[model samples]
Target: MRIGVLALQGAVTEHIASIEKTGAQGLPIKRVEELDGVDGLIIPGGESTTIGKLMRKYGFIEAIRAFADQGKPIFGTCAGMIVLAKRIAGDEAGHLELMDITVARNAFGRQRESFECDLEIKGIADPVRAVFIRAPLIEEVGPDIEVLTLYKDEIVTARQGHLLACSFHPELTDDYRLHQYFADMVEDSMTANL
Candidate 1:
């Protein structure tokens, strides 16, 4: 299946590499029309505000929302997670609110505070090494959301319906399990359609 990665900014190349590793066709989506044929989308880690602005400027906000509304799988990481959150507690400038969670931006402080840690993700058998760079913290997940991974007592990864969000960057690591998981979801979706 073809998977599109939001190429507005941030770790786009890494995510593209991960998608390719998963044996899925990787498409860098900059314009709205590029999203048309993808089976799933990945909103990679980046500056949320800038990405949001670019998304709006390029008319991708509505297109992405419409895609998610159609039950297509979406995996958002870091700032992407912020954009997907339903509410951003500390954000003065509004970001795209897509998921049913409340997030606090830069909860881990500045770039110096950025660190890596082992995460016990719900479905993964081994501890996943998560990379957090100026990451946000998920403060509250709505009843519909399922918490997936945590770090130092804070929620960092969660899934609700077809939307999966994480404050850490799994694409930075060599592990492709998470990407494979999302790919599995995409496969399931395609099979269901058939």
Candidate 2:
């Protein structure tokens, strides 16, 4: 399977490395046409506002939404999670608005407050290492959304069909299980369509 990392901003290389660890071909996607070559996409952590602006400026918003409409999986990490959120606390507009969740930007506090922890993610047998840096929190989720991992009683990871959102940086760690999980999602999606 091939996976594409939305290279608009944030942790693109780390995400690519993690994807490659799963024995999948990983590519950086900078243009809309690049979307056609991948079975899955990962939007890495970064400044949500900037990523949103760039997505709109480069016409990626519609292209990405269309890609997801095909039932392919899309994983969003940290700021990328915010991008996928249908509603953001204290904000009127949201980017992509694909995932059925509400997010609070920087709910983990500032950069100085960044921290790491091992989290018990649903569907994974062992705890996964997580790094939160100015991360958002999933305050609410739709009925279809499944809460996956939580940190300190706050929702940090969730899934809704083919979409996965995490408020922590999974790519930043050596553990590739989460990436492998996403790859499996992509593969399953491909199989279901066939």
> Residue-wise lDDT of candidate 2 within 23-60, one digit each (tens)?
99999999999999999999999999999999999999
Q: Which ten residues in a row have the lowest lDDT in candidate 1?
A: 90-99
lDDT of 1: 0.88
The stretch of ten residues in a row with the least summed lDDT in candidate 2 is: 88-97
Q: Using Cα atoms with residue i matched to residue i, what is each candidate's TM-score against the true structure?
A: 0.96, 0.99
Q: Please estimate how well model 2 matches the true structure, expressed as its whole-model Cα lDDT.
A: 0.95
Top-lDDT structure, candidate number: 2
Which one wins on TM-score? 2
- Model 1 stretches astray by more than 4 angstroms: 91-94
